[model samples]
Target: MTQEAHVTQGPLTTEAGAPVADNQNSETAGVGGPVLVQDQLLLEKLAHFNRERIPERVVHARGAGAYGTFTVTADVTPYTRAAFLSEAGKQTEVFLRFSTVAGNLGAADAVRDPRGFALKFYTEEGNYDLVGNNTPVFFIRDAIKFPDFIHTQKRDPYTGSTEPDNVWDFWSLSPESTHQVTWLFGDRGIPASYRHMDGFGSHTYQWNNAAGEVFWVKYHFKTDQGIKNLTAEEADVLAGQDPDSHQRDLREAIERGEFPSWTVGVQIMPAADAAAYRFNPFDLTKVWPHADYPVIEIGKLELNRNPRNIFAEVEQSIFSPAHFVPGIGPSPDKMLQGRLFAYGDAHRYRVGINADHLPVNRPHATEARTNSRDGFLYDGRHGGAKNYEPNSFGGPQQTGRPLWQPVDGLTGGTGNHPTPLHAEDNDFVQAGNLYRLMTEAEKERLIANLAGAISQVSRADIADRAIGNFANADADFGKRLEAAVRELRG
Candidate 1:
């Protein structure tokens, strides 16, 4: 049989932009035998198909993103000299990615998980990324335990599935997880949609003003759509019915012109205040009481456009808390400190060294002038320009100004040391306060939710240890949890 030479240009092309001769059928060995390896089209298609996916993030594997604008509403010059936040009414382009912390790329959307709220501001100075979560606190304060905590949330080595024993055992052993664990088992754990929940820059960060005066800041993005959540039963149904429920809702809402928005606010504390604060201000597992430092409205973030390609735009996009403009810098927050290095390093490995050169990640209003030269996917944007500094040839020179003020008074010896505790740094205090603040119905729901998970553990000791942390937070909380777990397990 003679294969017809159906050669025609109809806009279908290969990766090299060459027009494809045939896409429907492969060039086979006389139409019956094994396919010919010399068929370049078949080889190309197979190779590309095999390499289509990059490694999914160890955490936050499932995500959705959109392009948006952040409009400054309040003058914050006294707080920081970051160009994007320098003047009221100033606007900056932003890309926000919402994600589930523990689920895989193919996992259902409506699960009880901490949603990643990573925002990238394409500023005039450079890109500023505020990487955070839906909750104000996290399970553990230190980054050293991060891998262990995530491991428990992931698949068990023996069973190849997430095990209740692993999760409860870790949470039980780590007392610092009480506050965040309480938050996680509450009603807000499973958000109805990304737009319906609040986002928090969970770690404390430093903001230095033009005067070189420093302040600690925490960001909050209150959803304009208002807080809405799904019960475990409702979430299970939704997950089964529509696996991409949250992602679909976000895209459809923007398409209909119902742009999702959040009122951005910041809790600012004087640099001096952090030293003698009631609790460790830099602790990732605690929240600054609103009474002590009120949240001042700063701006509004509205997502108006969805990404055209999930892989090229959303998945390839990278963020790091270290990606800051002048006046903004890291705090002593242990987790935040660790993330400053881990995030960028992960992007470099997963997305390649030239990930920043991607359209979604490149600076919007300013050119990224760096000594960084060619690597994988290098676009040759430099175009034979001088890649070195201190050259007689007017290349980009340093402004002799650091992004943030230097820390003073370092007298401690370097070793594995726990952070010095403040006046009220007990891990359970805030958790207890949170539990007490909840209404009776809310507490009931929280206890039920916690019990449902805790009861799944095979060992009674692990259940007791997990319940004990909550008990330390509040006697009533522990008692109720104990009762609920017993009933459920029976």
Candidate 2:
């Protein structure tokens, strides 16, 4: 058979390139009879459809993403030698995903939960992923408690609904969650939109200059739209009306040319200052007050383009804390260290082994060659190079860049210790400070919100314990929450 006779320029085809005939109808014994077994297209379509969906993320599953550009407005080369931040006014391609942390795939976007602010930067060195949340601090500092913390936020096994009792029980027992719980019950719990929320690389990271000088750093992506949030009433109403309020708001705003933006800033603390800091700098549950380490303006990030395909680009898109370029590295932050493994593992399980080879996740600004080859859906095109290194055949080799300096000493035996190294690292101080900073109206709202949730707990002991946590935050705070709960119950 000649090539021209067997192949046609255009037509719907099967996997083998055989033209699909009669796609509208299946091959049948007769018009009114049973279908024939020869209907390969029907079987193929059914099989593909059955396996269309992969597992949704265990957390931050409901999300919206957009393509954007990050333009460096200030020179940060003195602090970090990352090629993307090497020069002022340099623009890097970026993709940003905004999400609700505790929500299911079908959950309302306006729920009162921490929002995720993840970014993937396509730079010359490779792709750098900043997987962070909108809040400056998290509920738990250590990664070991992550699964337990998340379980509290999820549905009750018996009821299949989120239980306030479970949530309160966990937070009350885990005093380290006090700071973040305070933030959650505050007015800002429900952000007005993804555009108005500020993002933070909550964990401390390591940044080194071209001279091998290392500095501890944290990122703050302050929303240019300003911090706007929905009140409890507003969020509740929006949740009932439009489950996808946030997703729709972002997509429509970008389409209308009102692109949202953020001012990128970094709080750079000298490596030597970390040990002497008032609080543990690497603690995910705490934040560095602006009075101490002020944020330095570094860049502006603007989301100008909506994704063309939500599933292929946004749903399948992956981000990880381990994806670092030269000059930028991880710190001893416990949560971050665990994420360095967890995020990549989740991506492999949910998006396939070669998830990075996908168009949305692939490195665009530089060539990505790796010894990693041949997995499920291995779509990368690695030109005939040997998959293994140390070969006479010329292939891509390791970089000549200087390796990161290792830690000078190690202390403490490996077992789950309830307390951290810092003697003054009690969880209540910061949470109390936060409460004292709030205005009367904000405090009233916080009390009301906290009471409303705690009031629903069927367990009186759990509710009382939660009230104690509030009291520990502030005598006034605890009294108000206790009063509110009593009044509501009565």
Candidate 3:
């Protein structure tokens, strides 16, 4: 059916399909004598209005999404056996969501925060989700500290507002946060719009080919619109003038046939090289330098269509890193490991257990066949199929082959253990390198940004500790930050 047929132009009817004679006036007893309880329509309207909203996501509550196509432009058969990327020119339907990390649903888009770049691929094999962020590195390497890090970013319990003291204290204590903190304070922190920034699958992932050869890979989506960013003053003005600037820009551009696109690429590392790499390749707080493994262009991702219903199509949609195809699998990255369980569990709580049955979340090219039966909002898609395996009724059975190859070594007994340290694993080196690579004006802006927040911290010692981390990264960075903060506080 065409889009126009979906529009209802007939006489109004109740949800139960009963024709309603009068919708404007409720059926009252003797003309508004206490608004009679017999009016089912009035009651229905009131109840639905009360329950219109579902629970907002704990993080990334402010977001926008678009429907798109990912056309493979290169042959990667030597690296992966994923059916979606099996041949050049293959196209897959995709939905991409852009979000702010710390904002609520009503928050403004032109803020200085890391944007979430979560992509869902509706492929022949199954749904593949790449849950990433705009920046390649994160605040911390381990998932154990995730709650604490977010707590620092969120409103303080006592004050009920985000406190600079809380944010700085956490970063000061966790030296590993230096790299991401630097990135956060830089020019790109406030992206000009969703279409102008780059996105990265920050964590390492495992990719195995048909020959069972394993490789580690990272994904990058370089915007075709070119990089653009807003300074602090520009962002403040835009935020106040029009809070929905980013969303409006994206929607109107698509409406005008100016679809945004990104060049898709991946940096693939041989599985053996990961063992003896300079730093732990799986560290979420670090990046594998392009010199070690250059990104190879593989595809083009174009967002040509806007969501018809923001609430149904975008809000109800879900993405999980654990939703992998045959060739792709999770790495040993601690942050990625925790997310494998957390993302799916969050959807079950926030969106309901049958969330997968929603049109926006369902697989496109293949029917989802599972013995798992009913839950909230279950559509009865299986239609009385056997609910369990090993039945005479011929229920769906699992494939004998596993999705990816198993790890070779299994030496350690189960206990609380830290990731094994590699030769050059300390946190400061990369952050320091980033600082030195900045142009003089860029460095000035970064220092000013850091100082602006650090100076707001009440405790002098906390401010000192925070600046000390930068000092550890580079003596000049620390000195300049200290001088800037001192001037600001004075």
Highest-scoring model, lDDT: 1
Q: Which stretches of model 3 miss by more than 4 angstroms?
A: 1-7
The residue pairs found clashing in candidate 1 are none
Model 2 Cα lDDT, one tens digit per residue, 187-255: 889999999999998889999888888899999999999989999999989999999999999999999
Candidate 1 error regions (>4 Å) = 1-10
Candidate 3 per-residue lDDT over residues 1-490, each given as its tens digit: 6555544767787778788889998776786577889899899889999988999988898999999999999999999999999999999999999999998899999999999999999999899999999999999988889989999989999999999999999999999999999999999999999999999999999999999999999999999999999999999999999999888988998999999999999999999998899899999989999998999999999999999899988888999999999999989999999999989999999899999988899999898888777888888888877788778887777888667777676697998788777999987888999999999999999999999989999999999999999999999999999999999999
Deviation in Å, model 3, residue 458 alpha carbon: 0.8
* Pairs of residues clashing in candidate 3: none
Backbone clash tally (model 3):
0
After TM-score superposition, what is the CA distance of residue 113 in candidate 2 from its true location, in Å?
0.6
The lDDT of model 1 is 0.93
The candidate that achieves the highest TM-score relative to the unseen native structure: 3
lDDT of 1 by residue, 143-194 (tens): 9889999999999999999999999999999999999989998989999999
Q: What is each predicted model's overall lDDT from 0 to 1?
A: 0.93, 0.90, 0.93
Candidate 3 lDDT at 463 equals 97
